[model samples]
Target: MERSETTATTRLSTWRQVKRMKLLYLLLLLPVVQLFIFQYIPMYGVLIAFKDFKVARGIWDSPWNNFEHFRTLFSDFIFLRALRNTLIISGLKLVFGFLAPIVFALLLNEIRHVRFKKITQSISYLPHFMSWVIAASMLVEIVSPQRGIVNYVITLFGGDPVHFLASKTYFVPMLIISDIWKEMGWAAIIYIASMASISPELYEASDVDGANRLQKMVHITIPAIMPVVVILFLLRLGNILEGGFDQILNLYNPLVYEVGDIIDTYVYRVGLVEYKFDYSAAVGLFKNVVGVVLLVTANLFVRKVSDHGAW
Candidate 1:
């Protein structure tokens, strides 16, 4: 009888605690509903990957074709091309785009002037706010062979005008450079915030020890923010197969497709434009599965190397 009374008292205390937090729990309902609507609900479409989906039959009535779509995707040369380009572009971005933000943050942190630093940061971050469509249009105009400022400058220097966007040789480099420009400043914001959290006393101690600016940066600043860098790098590895779709779609032409086409663009062309929905779904599912695997592998590697991980 005494043990039962004790149990009832514990239950009453738990219920009172939950009742006190009811307002906070109610506030979370919207986000939970949004997640269910936008993320979890759409996941049902993954079944289309296994079905020969027809508009007339609809998703539920569509006949299952098993692995036929997967076989078709593997046999297609274009799919292979898309896969290869996706890897190459994503790898290059990981190397260059990933480092650009870190460098920018370090340089910005070193600036001593307040007004100048604010102005410079504002200018750097402006490009990130522009839509890819607008940015790509501006780039196209700037690189136009006939009337562009770039070509005019080339002509003034007695050099041949080059069609940068159309040429296979230049397309990949342009993609990498433009991607870095678009995202660098925005990405640097996280690093700058991390740097701000580091105690200023550390830098003062380094100064007292006769360390130069570069020395303090190397020994203190970089080491302090290395955790953020590793976490971002691990997250990027998860998207190794996602060659930026919007930027590429806006900038690419048939001439540069050999080097510029990626999995997302391929899906757009084959799925929506050509109406091969099932095939596209299969390709998407494959990409997602690979991404999950890569994310898990990268997280494991990071956990082994350091204490930090996505989990």
Candidate 2:
């Protein structure tokens, strides 16, 4: 048949093109090998979740406990507390932290003055490059009750000096606000780049129709970069179980643990601090499985709502 001949000819042409680009394929080999060695090879460690893993016996010789760890995890109060905290913290982060970057990008794009815009942007994202350790120290100083600037201001206003970090009422808000402040401008870079790619002709057409800056932003700019926004949201959703481990670990104290403790910190305390490796590994596996399920469901939901989806 003519169709069979055309298919054969197409395959031959594709083969020739690939032969021309063989060096690029050679360049790609390094990362493929690294992915296997770093990401894929370590996955066998998940077997620890199913085993009563002893250090002396090693993974291979460790006897299978068959689902006992999982059974205990569901019944355990500590594990349940970590799970609940992870959900609450991560959900609040998605609610408040998600839109900060998008809003930053939109506001930045409206700045017609080039020099001020550049300086402001440089300062805004600077905190993102700082390690959480240094940031946490600075945050503690700012919120410290005895001699801190925040308390000094409160005293000036005749209000009582309140310890922001130590309070259950204020701890989560501090976390959210600090997180948004640190990461907003850095994350906004994506939306800014997407906005830059929009054709000027559309804006020109909008100008012809007497559209204002805000109107153009809502109708022209936002719609154009929505696919990028949705993709980033989906990726962030997939990592929802993580709950900003490094930030919380650096900033939180025993006093705040009742409100601030999450899955990663819980895992650290269980596995490293208490040396319950098998139990910690099971918790980690549960986190990853939930992440995967959320990712798939988000993908499905996005597909129904819009044509631009991860699929």
Candidate 3:
């Protein structure tokens, strides 16, 4: 009888807690439902990757293609080049893009004037809201050899104007710079929020210790936000195989394909353009598998080293 009463009390307590948080839970339900409908449900379509998918037969009725598509992808001459381009571009973005945001956050944190800082941050973040198509078109105009602003400046300086977008040698760097410009400000917002959460008492204490501005930044500000940095970096590692598909597709041309084409663009060209869905699916599945493995590895490393992980 006593045990039964205890169980009943526990259930009542749980019910009360849920009742207290009911509105918040209700608000979360819409996104949860949408995720189920859009994100989770679409995962079922991934089965087509393992099959010789046909429109008439549909995903369910398609025959299993085994590993034939993967074999074909591996044997393709362009496969290595696509893989190399994807890795190189993603790697550079990870290194430069990752650092750019952190540096921007740090610099913004040091700004003393409120109005100026707000204006600077607002202007910097504006580009992030622009569609990739619009941004890419703007970039093309700026980099055009004939009349683009970048080439115009080069010519003004007595140097020959370079074809930035068309040149294989310049494409990767151009992509990296454009990506940094678009995303650094947006990414820095996270770091800035993390910085805000840092206790002002720590800065006061550092000031009392006669620590200079740089010293305080290095000791207090950075350490306070290090966890946020670690988590974001780990997340980036998970998607190391993906080089911004929309941005790349909009920016790159066939002339720069050797240096600029990534896995996503290659998949699009092969699947939709060439009607090689099986081959593209195989490539996509490979990327997804690698991403999952990398995410798990990064999570484990974070847990072991810092006692914090994605989970």
The candidate that achieves the highest lDDT relative to the unseen native structure: 1
Q: Assess every candidate by TM-score.
A: 0.94, 0.96, 0.95
Identify the runs in model 3 with alpha carbons over 4 angstroms from their true place. 1-8
* Rank list by lDDT: 1, 2, 3
Which residue segments of model 1 deviate by more than 4 Å? 1-24
lDDT of candidate 2 over 1-311, digit per residue (tens):
99999999999999999999999999999999999999999999989999999999998799999899999999999889888888999999998899989999999999999999989988999999999999999999998998899999999999999989988889999999999999998999989999999999999999999999999999999999999999999988999998999999998888888889999999999999999999899999999999999999999999998887776
Off by over 4 Å in 2: 1-8
Better of 2 and 3 by lDDT: 2
Candidate order by decreasing TM-score: 2, 3, 1
RMSD of 2: 1.5
Model with the higher lDDT, candidate 1 or 2: 1
**Model 1 lDDT at residue 276:** 92
The root-mean-square deviation over C-alpha atoms between each candidate and the true structure, in angstroms, is 2.4, 1.5, 1.7
| lDDT minimum window of 10 residues, candidate 2 | 302-311
lDDT of 1 at 212: 99
TM-score, cand. 2 = 0.96
Q: Write the per-residue lDDT of candidate 3 for residues 38-117, one digit (tens) a residue.
A: 98998888887888989789889989988778888778878778888889999999999999999999999999999999
lDDT tens readout by residue for model 1, 60-109: 89999978999998899999999999999999999999999999999999
Candidate 3 lDDT at 18 equals 92
- Between candidates 1 and 3, which one is better according to TM-score? 3
